[model samples]
Target: MQAEDSTTLEATLADGRRMTLSLPATDAPWAADGLRALRPVPPTHTGRGEEPPTLPEQPALPLEVAILGFGL
Candidate 1:
């Protein structure tokens, strides 16, 4: 969908998610250029109805960094 002064784009990802983006008229040209530069690639899915892979949990880092020469 498009408004008088802006353009709206709707898209779906390979993971079955939906997204919407709105850009002002001045920046709309970049969106067109980006779309024109897209190249098709093989899909990542390997099985039907399989959930997406997730990252392993990471330990929280120590907050011992110095700020302005003063240790926190």
Candidate 2:
């Protein structure tokens, strides 16, 4: 199973019982006290307009490297 959130990545476990790590639920993941203690900050905002910022565009990569190394 994969946990969906700010990023996407696959997870693997060796044995069913040996998988002991626990993760915060995406739903109600942050508690008031936890968030307050963490004092998390958002990325600095930029732009003059009220519209949301678009994701940064990526450049094309070398064909061989992309295919062999990344399988992209």
Candidate 3:
């Protein structure tokens, strides 16, 4: 197993929000094998006769990753 390391990353989102993240420092390509898909949630607080309108399916946005200053 690789030794755990910490690194800080800062970025400005498209909506002008600044965000920071702390992640493990490594030179290897990241993997998604440990990730699991999320389940859908049922609607809440519906009226006796009101029905929620069906939403159009939207394409998933590509993930963005930053790997600044990897390794100690």
Candidate 4:
């Protein structure tokens, strides 16, 4: 794999799949966010037509604690 430029990258996978990615810029944080956005979401349930067991809900947190936790 090699970067063609600040906004372009080229690579050939093990299975001979050639890839080229051209981005708006070379910012690492933006690239990471883009990669994370491209990832597929996993299914919530197993494929066996059965729902996963749900856990009992806990009591809600105090408003101040919830706000602090969101910062972290």
- Any residue pairs clashing in model 2, and if so which? none
Compose the digit string of candidate 4's lDDT tens values, residues 1-72: 666456666777657999987767445765664432443345588557868899999998889999997896
Candidates in order: C-alpha RMSD to true structure: 8.9, 16.9, 23.6, 13.0
lDDT of 1 at 42: 73
On lDDT, the candidate that comes out on top is 4
* TM-score for each predicted model, relative to the true structure: 0.32, 0.21, 0.26, 0.35
Quantify all predictions' global Cα lDDT against the true fold. 0.54, 0.46, 0.45, 0.66
Instruction: Please identify model 4 stretches exceeding 4 Å from their true place.
Output: 26-72
TM-score of 2: 0.21
True-vs-predicted CA distance for residue 53, candidate 1, Å? 22
Residue-level lDDT of model 1, residues 1-72, one tens digit each, is 222223555567767887666544445555665333433467787668867899899886555533534643
- Candidate number with greatest TM-score: 4
Better of 1 and 2 by TM-score: 1
Report the lDDT tens digits of candidate 2 across residue range 1-72: 443443332345434532222334344545433222332245486557587889899888878867888665
Question: Which regions of candidate 2 are displaced past 4 Å?
Answer: 1-52, 69-72
What's model 1's lDDT at 17? 86
Q: How many backbone clashes does candidate 4 have?
A: 0
- TM-score of model number 1: 0.32
